[model samples]
Target chain A: MEIVIVSLLNGLVYGMLLFMLASGLTLIFSMMGVLNFAHASVWMLGAYFAYEVSRFIGFLPALIIAPLLCAAVGAAIEVWGLRRVHHNGHVAELLFTFGLVFIIQRSVQMIWGMLPMPYRVPAALDFPLFTIYGANFPAYRGFMLFISALMLLAIWLMLKKTRIGLIIQGALTHPNMVSSLGHNVPLVFTTVFAGGCGLAGLAGVIGGNYLVTESSMADAMGPIVFVVVVFGGLGSLGGCFIASILMGMIQTFAVVIDASIGDVLKPIGIALSSETLLGEILTVPMARIGPLLPYLLMVFILLFRPRGLMGTRDT
Target chain B: MSTTLRAGAMPAPRSSLVGPIFRIFLIFALCMALPWLFYNYTTGRHSGFMLTMFSQMGMMAIFALSYNMLMGQAGLLSFGHAVFFGLGGYFCIHLLTAAGGGSLPVPLEILPLIAGLCSMLVAIVFGYMATRQRATAFAMITMGIGELVATAAVMFHAFFGGEGGVSSDRMIDRSLFGLTYSQGVQVYYLIVAWSFISILAMLYLTTTPLGRMANACRDNYERAQFMGYDPKFVRFIQFALSGLFAGIAGGLSAITYEIVTFDSVSGALSANALLMVFIGGTNAFGGPILGAVLITLMQSGVSLISNSWLVYVGVLFIGMVTFAPAGLAGLIAMHSPLQQAGRLKPLIVPYIRIVVPGLVTLIGFVGVVELLSFKTIGAAQGKKLVLFGNPIDATTAQPWLIVTGMFLLGGLWLWREGRWFHTLWEAMMADLKPKKGAAQ
Candidate 1:
């Protein structure tokens, strides 16, 4: 019962964080019709920025400032850089963002050097919030959950209630009609891009402290983010949310277990020696296969359900 | 926004001169002479540096050119082309190992071809599934498939051999021509020969009916369908054929290195192919060759000085896409009018103006890169970081100031001269065009 409860809470926290990162990427991908390969780089920058800010100021101020700076960077890149390549078509746009990935990664390395930043949680939030069956649930993780929840609510309110939000929604579903309605489509794009980067930054600020804030964090997170985006389907925030949570749970749960195909086959009277390929496959633990699950799910989704679970349109 | 021009409509037929028979002879000549040229003129048999580089170039040329067949002609963007190349290498190594054990009857020289064919077989399955979609969906599918395969390559030990990867003895079985294929130069020549034959075959493929239809489908699928061409079939065939060439490249790699690893099939290799194809200019048949050679040279040369070379490549790539959408081939094609009118000589002054600033910028950039990389990777390796026999500390203010100054000066000069160069280029081109009435 304790193991189950712990996994469930961890999964929720992990899922929420994935949602924060994937939501921004989904919005940008849906609106622009270009998968921003540099999205994870933006997340990495947020963490680096937060770390730098925290060194000079308090953690609270750093969190707010870092995300805003990321938004500004995103706006500048969209307005000045991506806009120029938009007319060249999709491949060119993808290539442009792909180029930005290298630049941003190297620039981060140059600025921060190659060492991992020690961005610790604030003392106030460092202690355990509670104990579940004698297992301590750290207060920092609880704070992360709260912050992500707040973000989710804020995004929901903005999307449903605000005028700009409504415009963004209309543009997302029907871009041609939004333009015909005299809306500044370019302005909408800039705003959406900024918002997406800001969200990615928020995830970075929170996750950087939660996880290891290393130079290779971006590369590690990049493929998973891409898997989420592709698995959730392009242009579907709801699908993105679902896919993020599912992936988070899959990864979290897969790590905790030690069962293998051999164990599953044991009851069926199928025994294998260590001499064969099948034996090797059967004996590998679930912990060892944790990294393979996301990719396997992604391939299965692309092959069987091209549109994804909650996706409204095909990518 | 500029109006979309429907440029690609129909594919051109085969070239009249240098038919398949002549091309085959040319390939043979080029291959046989390559090893002799490398051995006699340059460093002979000392770890086979020239031969190794040549073999690498040949393989990559095939890989990049094959990738272009999908991107340029078929209008399909694949992020997983390394899958075929890596698979080809793995199979070739496996075959070589089997032949060494006397389980297989194939000669070492023909093993690469077998690998290429095996890659084509895998391509048929992957291509059939992948060609079902178009555009973004197609790209996503390819990425997913690539990731799946890559993960499996690391996961399974039977075929992929896990992280340490698979290695085999290249000196396997009897030689086809009654000579032991044991030397670096011999293997290099074999790869070159196979590369030439593969490229010629690829070139021939583009002139066939299937290739023409691929162009037709790429330009307008609806129109192609109206003309009784199946775009799906066209894409499938092209994808398979491209895989075949990529596999040949892979086989050459396997034969040369005698090993294949997860890195061989990684996303980086796929990205490299994309970079090469785009840089070379996708439209021309020989464009990928130029891209492959330039990229390989840069990889060998520039990477020795800087770890941040990828950043420069990325920036150049983005700039290329935004400014010259058609690529280096397209840029060269743009100058054809001036060359045809014999007014190319007049533009030399303007070209030098631009080039001088460009050279300054490049020097500044490379210097900064070398300095930074020397501080990091070099320092970690415990190598003395020196410039002209003077040890320089990266933390020092002097080096920083010098780099900043060079960057500023070079950038300002280039910005000022680039516009003047552009205007002069236009004027020269206008002057070069023949009089309309006289031409008629």
Candidate 2:
């Protein structure tokens, strides 16, 4: 019971964080029709920025300032970098962002050194919030959850209630129409791009401390964020959220499930040794393949439902 | 010259092959003589480094060309191309090991072919799934497949050999022409021979009906569909054929290095292939060849100086994407119009003006990069900041002030001068309009 409850909570926390990152990517991808390959790197920059800002000021101020700075960088990238290559084609845009991943990651290294930064949870939120069967759940997690929930609410209110939000909604579903319908499409694109990057920054500020604030963190998170975006389907934030939580839960649960195909086959009187490829496949534990699940899910989704679960447009 | 006008098109078929065939032969001759040239003239002896670098350039050239088959011909932006290359290397090494153990009797000459076939096999399976979609969906699927294979390589130790990867001796029992594959020169020649064959084969493929159809699909998918060509089939075949060449490159890498690591199939290498293809200019056939060699030299040269060379590569890649989407080849090809109009000499003054400011801006950027990189890494290593053998203090405000000032001022000046250069270029181009009209 304790294992189940704790895993569930941990999975939720991870799911929320994944959603924060993936939501931005999905927004940019849906609106701009180019996968921002440097999205995760921007999130990394957010964490680095927060680290620097928090060092100079406090954690609260860093939390606000870092995301804004990320937004500004996102604006610059969209306006200066992406706009020039827009005429060249989508491939050029993707390559541009892909190159940015290397530049941003190395720049982070150049500034912060090769080692992980010492970004920590605030002292105010460092203590345990609750215990499930003697396992402590930190107060910092509650803080993370609150921030994510607040962002979600803000995103929902902005998209569904406000005028700019409605335009954003139109852009999400009927992007061509949004451009054709006398809207400031370029402005909308820049805003969406910046806002998405800001959300990723917020995730970084929170997740940097939750996980290890390392140089490699971007690479580790990049593919998974892609998996979430693709699996949830393009142009669907609801699907993005669903896919993230589902992936989070699956990963969280798979780590503890020690069963293999061999174990399943054992009851069927089909014993397999570790001599052959098939045997090895059968004998390998689920925990070992936990990291591969998102990719597998992404592949399966792309194969069966190219539009994704809740997508209106085909990716 | 006419081909340069249609820059973002398929490789131009030569009406008469006499000149091109002669050039091809000459290029191959150069490749064959390169090892000896380096051995006797420059180094006074065989330099393993030169041989290795040459061999690497050959393989990467093949890899980049294969990548261009998908990106340039089929319009498929695949992020997982190195899967074939890396897997091809792994298979070739295994083949080499088998030959060493007296089981496989195939000569070293045929191993690359076998590896290419093996790589094509994987490409066929993955291509089936990937080619099911086009554009972004296709790219995503490839990315997934690549990530899957990469993860599996680390997960299963059966074929991929886990983290330590697999290694084999290049000095296998069997050799061609009764000569043992012991010397670096021998291996280098073997790679060169294969590289020539692969290049010729790919060049021939560009003139084929399938290649033309692939280009047609790239330009207009619906039109190709109307013309009764299945776009997916074209992409699949192109992907597979490209995989064959990629695999052959991987085989060459295996023979040269005699070891394959998980890094071989990593996303980084995949990105490296993309960088090479794009930097060379995807439109022209020889573009990737230029990219492959330039990148190989840069990799060998720049890596010795700084661990942060990837940042430079990244910046270069992004810069190319933004400023020169057609690549270095494209920039050279762009000069054909000026040369044709006999107006090349007129733009010299404007070009010099732009070039001077560009150099200043570049130097400033380099200074900033050095200072920043030195502040972190150089200090960590307890090494003093040195530029052109002059000891410098990174902590000093003077260098920082000069670098920032130069960067900002030079950048502004360059922008203004660049606009003026563009105006002069336009005027030069306009001068051709009336001459062409009168000729018509």
Candidate 3:
């Protein structure tokens, strides 16, 4: 029971972190119809930037500055790289970003070396915030949840209550209509692209410390984020949110489960040996197969529901 | 008019057939002569490195061409195409092991064919699920499938052999050619023959009805549907055929390397296939062949010199995606119309002007990358930065400034020269257009 509670809390924290990245990716994907393969790379850059800034100035300012730096980089990439390839088509744009992943990763390794940075939680948030059954939930996780909730509220308010948000919403569905109405659609695109990157950067700033700040971090996190976006369905942030938490729960809980298919089937008088492939598969513990569960879920979901759980548009 | 039309139609098939046949023969001859060309008579043997590299190029050519069947011909961008390749290699290695143990009586020559058929079966199963969606969805599903298989490969040790991977002896002692399979040259010849056949088969596929319909569906699925063709079925068949060829390449690799690892089916290899196809030019039939050869050369050659070879490849890929979407083949194709017009001589001066700055800029960029990498990776490895036979200190500021200045200045000059060249090209093309119209 205590393990379940701790896992739930841990899962929530991880889910919120995933949502922070997924929200940006979904927004950019919905607006441009080009999935930024380098979105995770940008997140990695943000963590590095924040580590650099916090090394000198401090963490609070780094939080604000790191995301801004990521936004600037995103803007530059849009104006120079993506915009030029835009004429060629979406596949070209995707390939361009995909190529950027290699460059960004190599560049990061060049600058930071091939080791994990020691980016730790602030001293103020280092202590336990509360006790979940017997497990002590850290204050840093609370901080993460607090910031994520604030971001969620801010994004909702911006999208619902602001003129720029209205323009963005209009452009999402009707770009030509928005363009002819005298709103600078290209500038809006740059803004959204930068804004999405900024969100990713913010996620990096918080999650980097919670996780490990390393060069391969992007590679590790990239596919899972894609899984969340696809599982939630395209063009639906609400779905993305639900999918993120569900994935977080699945990953978090899968690690704790020690039972195998053999254990479940043993009650029905089915004895299995590990010699055969099917037997080996059935006998393997769920914890050992934890890393593979998300991809399996994604494939099953894709095969069954191509539009995802709550997709508003065709994938 | 009727006689002239019939004459034109009659010559079309023969004339078209003759060129490809000639090209195929030429390619076969070149491939056959390559080992001899690199032969070290002093040692009384072929250069092992050269033989291995050439053999790798042939296998990769088949792999890249197979990938192009999906990307270029069928317009399906698969991120998990390596699954079939890897699986095929795994099966081939296992079969080779069986043959060695006398459990299977099959000769090594026909192993690749059996591997290809196995891959085709897997493709039919996977393709049925994958071909249901088009465009981005297809790409995503393929990616998911790729990740799943790669993860399972590591977990399911029975088939994949875990981290150490599966290995087998190539000398199964069952060759129809009556030659012992112990020599590297013999294996090289086997690869060359298989590559030649595979290339010809893939080329022939392009001229078939299904291939044309695949292109039709790629360009406009609705239009193909209106023409009473199921785009799904076309994609499925094309996907399966592509898998067959990829499997053949995988089998060749298994035989050559005598091992099959999870890396063969990993995302990196899949990305490598994409890089090869895109770099070679997807629009041309022979683009993948060019790409496979060039990339294999770079992998074997450039990687030896630079720690940051991937950076160069990434930059080159991005540059192609942005500026040269038609790729090396497309760039070469651009010059043909001018050559035919008898007006190619005038552009030589402008071309030289562009090339000079381009080379300078490339040198500058490479210098910057090398210096930075040397400062980090090379410094850790305790390697000195050597340029033009001079060991220079990467810690110093002087080399940095010079390279940066060169990059900026050369870039400016290249941009100006590029504009001039573009105007000149446009003028020449415009001039040729009118003359061609008049002639017609």
Candidate 4:
């Protein structure tokens, strides 16, 4: 029970981080119909930027400044890079971002070398928040949860209550109509793209230290974020939120299960050895196959529910 | 928005002097002679580096062309195409092991074909699932499958051999030919022969009805469906066939390197295929061949000179995506009508003008990249920043200022020259348009 509670909290923290990245990607995909392959790279850039800023000025200022920088970078890419490639088609746009992945990764390496940064949780958030049985939940984890929830509320209110939110929502379904109504669709696009990237940046600000701030951080988090976006369903933030938590739970809980197919099958008179491939697969603990579960879930979801859990349109 | 022009619709230049068959043979001859061309008199043997590079080019050509079957011909963008390639190599290595142990009666030469068949089977199963969804969904599904297999490859120690990967000896003692396949040059020849066969086969496939239908589906999915063809089936078949060729390439790689690692099946390799096909030109049949050769050259040659070669590739790719969607082949194809109309002479001066500025800009850009890389990666590796036998201090601001000046000024010059060249080319093309209309 203690393990379950700790795992649940950990899962929630991870899920929220995943949501922070996936939300931006989902927004970009829904708006421009181009999957920004460099979304994680941008997140990585945010982390690096925050690391640099926090090294001198401190973390609080980094929380504000790094995201703004990411937003500026996003706006520039949308204007100079993506806007130019827009004429080629969505595939070209996607490829352009894909190319950016390589450039960003190499550029990061050139700037920072191949070592992981020493970005850490703030000293103020260094203490234990609470004790669940024997496991002490770190104050940093609570801070992460608090920030993510605040972000979630802010995004929801911005999309639901504000006048710009209404206009953005209007632009999503009827871009031509929105354009005709004297709204700058292109500007809206830039804003949305920048805003999404800012969200990713914010996630990186906290998640970098939460995880590891390495050169391979983007590569590690990239595909899993895509999986979340896909599994949650494109164009649906609610679905994305649900999928993120589900994926987080699965990832967290699977690592602690300690059981395998062999355990399940033993009651049915099936004894599996660890020699052959099939036998090994059956005998391997769930913890061992923890990394594989999300991909398996994604594939299965895609196979059965191509529209995803709550997708409005077929992908 | 600028009107998009499809490269396939461009007129083929009349080649009265050189027939297609002769061109193929000439290219084959060049490839066959490459090893000898780089031979060292002192060593009394062919250059191993040249042989390996050529062999890699051959295999990559097959891989890129196969990828083009989906991206170019069928308009299906795959992110997991390397899964087939990696699986094929893995199976081939296992087969080679069996052949080496004398249990498998199959000769080493036929191992690629067997590997290809194995890959085709895997593709059929995977493609059945993938082809169910078109466009973005298809891409996502393939990516998922790729991640799954790659993860599984690392997990399952049976087939993938874990991190150490699977290795095998090429000299299985079972051969159709009487030669012992122990030398690098011998493997190069084997690769060349297979590449020749595969390239011809792929080119032949482009003319077939299925290939034509694939093109039709890519251009107009609704119209193809109206023609009573199941677009799904066509995609599945194309996917499987491409996998077969990819597998063949993978098998050749296994033969060349004597090992297949998880890298072969990784997303990076799949991205390499995409890079090759896109950089080569998706619309032309010969585009991927050119792409494969150029990228392999860059991978082997440029990477040796600079640690940031991938950054150059990425920039080039982005440039291609932005300004030249038709790619190098498409750019070449654009000049065909001008050459045919005997109007190419006028553009020579403009071409030279652009080339000069282009080269200057390239040098400047390369200098900046090298300097930056040298400051970080090079400094860490304890390597001095050297340019043309001159050791430069990276800590100083002079080099940075010089390179940045060169980059900025050269870029401005290139941009100005490019506009002039574009206008001149457009005028020439406009002049030929009416004549072609009259001829039609």
Chain A TM-score of each model, in the order shown? 0.98, 0.98, 0.97, 0.98
Highest DockQ among the candidates is held by which one? Answer: 4
Q: Write the per-residue lDDT of candidate 1 for residues B199-314, one digit (tens) a residue.
A: 77887877766777778788898898776666777788899989988998998899899889998898888889999999888898778887898888778766665566777887
* DockQ per candidate, 2 decimals: 0.55, 0.79, 0.74, 0.85
Off by over 4 Å in 2: B1-18, B40-44
Quality of candidate 4's docking, in CAPRI categories? high
Task: Please give each candidate's TM-score.
Answer: 0.93, 0.96, 0.97, 0.97
lDDT tens digits, residues A166-217, model 1?
9999988788999999999999999999999999999999998998787788
Cα distance off (Å), candidate 1, residue A136:
1.9
Error of 4 at B62 (Å): 0.3
lDDT of 3 by residue, B113-170 (tens): 8998899999999999999889999999889988988888888888898888999999
Residue B96 CA displacement from its true place in model 4, Å: 0.5
User: What range of 10 consecutive residues in model 3 chain B has the weakest lDDT sum?
Assistant: B4-13
Classify candidate 3 by CAPRI docking class: medium
Expressed between 0 and 1, the share of native interface contacts present in candidate 4 is 0.82
**DockQ of model 2 vs. true complex:** 0.79
Give each candidate's fraction of reference contacts reproduced.
Answer: 0.52, 0.75, 0.64, 0.82
TM-score, candidate number 2: 0.96
